[model samples]
Target: MMTQNLLVELLVEELPPKSLKQLGDSFARLLAASLEMQGLMSKDAPVTAFATPRRLAVHIGNVAAQAADKAVTQKLMPVKVGLDAQGQATPPLLKKLASLGADASVVPQLKRALDGKTETLFWDSIATGISLTDGVQKALQEAITQLPIPKVMTYQLADGWQSVNFVRPVHALAALHGADIVSVNILGLQAGRETQGHRFAAKINPIVLHNADSYAQQLSTEGAVIAGFAERRAEITRQLTSAAAQEQLTLIDDDALLDEVTALVEHPNVLVGTFGAAFLQVPQECLILTMKANQKYFPLLDAQGKLANKFLLVSNIRPIDSAQVIAGNERVVRSRLADAKFFFDQDRKKTLASRVPELNRVVYHNKLGTLGERSKRVLTIAKAIGLELGGEALANQADQAANLAKADLLTEMVGEFPELQGIMGNYYARHDGFSEPIAQAIEDHYKPRFAGDALPRNPVGVCVALADKLETLVGLFGIQQMPTGDKDPFALRRHALGVIRILIEKELRLSLDMLLKQAKDAFAAQLIKENDFIFDLKIFIFDRLDSISREQGYRPQEIEAVLSFLPPYLIQVPRRLEAVRAFSDLPEAASLAAAYKRIHNILEKDMKKGPMPGVGSVRNLFIDIHFLMEPAEILLFNALNTIKPQADEAFEAGQYTQSLQLLAALKEPVDAFFDSVMVYTDDANLRANRLNLLTLLRDAMNRVADLSKLAVN
Candidate 1:
């Protein structure tokens, strides 16, 4: 069958801007997958997705007009059931054949084969291929059904009697193969070649697509619309850059903002607008956020990376005289900036300390008590961490910062923009004459709000950040509201990862178990019902750490070897993993790892068999060189005596790599012992001595990491 490019489009009311890209991509992928599964298109066929505020579309190349016929072999009932003992077709077999559009006349053509232990009857037939009309209809319906729509709207169709649910009200449907209409109907609209374009700027009221391949070109030329989401986004980026260049400023690079703006307009015209200089006095984050979030404008920054007075707005209509558009945008932005300024000025009237009492009214979580209580807990944790990290002076600063961190929740600025909670607290802290370190800590406590985000700037900030995350994690876990699957409404995974990042990246010597204990201690005993949650919480944190380590390029075995030891301080994990990786590369590494694994197995088997005669208990076993009868055991014992101290000294000095490297000298002795010596000998003293020696060797070799974990079976 010959193939031609195919196009499908759904024109509707404005779609949710944030979801348009996903919706378009999913529609194309699902539709193409369905077609390919139906044999109507190759899996490698090229697919293009187009999405705008008013449309979602896809164009797939090399799609067939009809799927190829398939030869199918379907299993029937067992021969004993299908054929009577006399070899005549039974009533059940006749009924089964009838269901498959066959009858007794065709029963003789059935084949018998062994299925498991029973001889089963099979029917061979050719399944007819689906026509383009049926295939396209099914694929389109499947695409729409599987679309990742954020929400669905129920609306009446043109007939007013029938209703349909969609992301938005569908006004038109367009689909074509080459130059011919595909004749598929959806949402009470038949597929056609016409689709509406830009609401106000289209040269034609209804854009007439010429063919499957001409959809994008015609839409761009006549419809005054950039149909492809990425193409439109790129065009807007280019324009923003050019506009920003003319003013000698740089555009704030926010991909999310760009995508939202792209979806808002089919015909993007980037125009620069100026705000009053008075507005620049407000924090740039506040003003920039208002412009990007409230008005979908791009804020420009000066050479020093400070927000400038001028910003760029993407207008849907491109007017010949652009002064009015710029002025209209500027007027709207000035009003927004004025509101921000008023909030900022009003929020500054009260110190963060004064606003602290109001947080008592705001609930953090019903089970976790009010934000005020949470703040008190965080302060306790922060103070403890600070003392551990930097003594009394830093503890004072962290305590003060944590006390006032959530105060901004009551501020006018934060009330209007929750994203400004920590930010406004910082401003208020400084305004209240607090020290710079304290003010910075208030803001930086929420540092690393996302992946790859920067950590808190100073020691005070680190203490508070760690405290705040720990409080949230321990409190929620205490209340039995722990995150399940992907439903982390409180962002516990992020909090755990935040803790992991701070501990590992900041090289904090704080113990993970100690921190969890500190957090749990801050909460009242009666309020925390999960008595054993610390163990579960520790496991959760380690799981997140394992994921982070893997993402950072550590191999699974290397990670397991280090993490299996459950090193008290997370700060030691990276170095330990590094040591394990380095140790694995040594020539003796394989033999040593294998021998360590063998030693482990021998010790485990002996321990399971209960205490030996000479060894009172495996746990209390000690090496006795006097019991070393075999030369191999004696030689290994000598090797251990010599190397153990050196490795121990290096490990104590935190020279993990060097320590693991020192163990490389044991490979030959270990191999010889395993080959020539029997750990479980007939002589009880020899067996006890061997097991004790292996236990000592295992302990010494695993100070940095479990070497047996690296062993390959």
Candidate 2:
């Protein structure tokens, strides 16, 4: 019944820096989960995860040496099937008892219980507890099997014959309970109290962890390593900050870069290194990217938010004199910077317009033609959108920008760093003597590339960006290459979200239906046959919109009500949602919503039943004042006449909240009409008139959103 803290470690070759944190966390989480599920530990036990370049470890608090025995009851079979006329054991009962390690001798002690509709025999027994040795073995194996390894490596063990698959070759396994070693094995390594650390910088060759609680302290002092991932990352941050402060330069903040660098070193030593200032002559984006991506260095920026000549490198070893480390890093970065400068210089020799023809040779998609054909389609869509947004002047600018947007894909710099495709195009377009708007548009056309990214800055950029996204969506959907589940190869979801953000956030007055139509028309020359793709594309975009709305904290019913109308101007959607939300708060909202539901159901039923004998056609039925005999029907008709104009005026003037609020005045008459008047009265004329009156009320109420959707019942 004794409990103590436990420590588990896996020593191996360097892990993948990008996924080290995930692997460590998963290993700790899965191990602790298995122990708790086996009743060997409480669910609330404290757990700590440690990850370095060479190891993954976890410490769990209050883990038991063995799980407590549990009493269990199990259903056997129906009493009729298990018993005979003489009230004795049957063959089926005896066989079931044997499978459970029991025999007919214990049948007299069995109990009977009602299960569902039948009386069944039940067996009760005490299940033996599992010892720590068996429990830890099972837990360790479960953790290893469920690890999210990015890539698996197959290597031979020490025997030179048996092989194992792992993220890296495992050299040692350590597991401790208090001061005692736990008997467990994985990847052909037996558990022990000793683990290797900081291959070169460790104060001791092999760290002998004294106990579960001493693992971290011993690794830090004797092993010369900071075993915890977060602690080491913080230390690196502290050093970087102090160093940058001394130089009066700000550290460029990139969490992903920081995590990767943290995973690349066990004993992180932050050192300052610099490249030649002349490299800054190239675009800062190109220089910064090369340093971060190729060199895994953090570039410092000056007060003006410009890249400085200095950069920071995280080294795994600390030496008395750091000059050698700094110089080596500087030498390596200079070569990378030189390559970037070369590409930038060579890319400028040819104009972006000159490179346009080369895109024909670059395959975009085999089914969708080359980048050249795609660019033409984009240019057409952009120009049309521009004309609609800003007349001929904007259209010409959009045309010029869209035509050169993809040209940079053929440039040397972009070829080396595809992340800089639109970026390099801006520089090339300016060097080609194009106007600032055109150049800027060429760059901004790929704006808002990811979630929460900025949108295009100017009208021309907006036109081009929308056109570019639309072409991708329509063309791909046309090819039936729509994204299914998590596999969005072309990132259609991102593109769709970009379009929705641009339209809604920018408050552009463009029509969604018109934009989709224009995008589809651009592909006409490609001779691509069309199906329900336009409709499907709309649904796709709307689905993205629904997700965005939900993230913005709108209720599902509220979103459904507004989207059900399929408003053409996406700019108006937020306003419509606001109106619906405001209307729901009104005291009359519930009654009116319920009345609308009733009215909708009545109209639906009548339409489905076809026309009455003397009713002419129900579809075209209109309320005639003479047909309004009942006072409730007359009162409702009079209310519509009085309220419709005011609501229509407010709606036309874009006062959506005011428009929906105006309908609140009709709740009394709507309730009275529904309570008194029978929509399907025996009198044919009266029934048709009442239905028409309800239909008119429905139209007025739904100008903002479908109120019936808000009906709770």
| Model 2, position 322: C-alpha lDDT score | 92
Tens digit of lDDT per residue, candidate 2, span 1-713?
78999999999899999999999999999999999999999999999999998899999999999999999998899989998989899999999999999999988888998998889999889988888889999999999999999889999999999999999999999999999999999899999999986788889978898999999899999998999999999999999999898889999999999999999998989889988889999999999999999999989999999999999898989999999999998999999999999999998888999988998998888888899999999999999999998999999999999999999998889889999989888998989999999988988999889998999989999999999999999999999999998999999999999999999999999999999999999986454685888998999999999999999889998899899988999999999999999999999999999988888888888778876765434667566788888898888889889999999999999999999999999999988887787777788877777777888888888888989899998
Per-candidate Cα lDDT values, in order, are: 0.91, 0.91
Candidate 1 structure, TM-score to reference: 0.97
Question: What's every prediction's RMSD, in angstroms?
Answer: 1.7, 2.0
Give the Å error, residue 662, model 2: 0.7
User: What TM-score against the true fold does each predicted structure earn?
Assistant: 0.97, 0.96
Question: In model 1, which runs have C-alpha deviations exceeding 4 angstroms?
Answer: 78-95, 117-119, 615-622
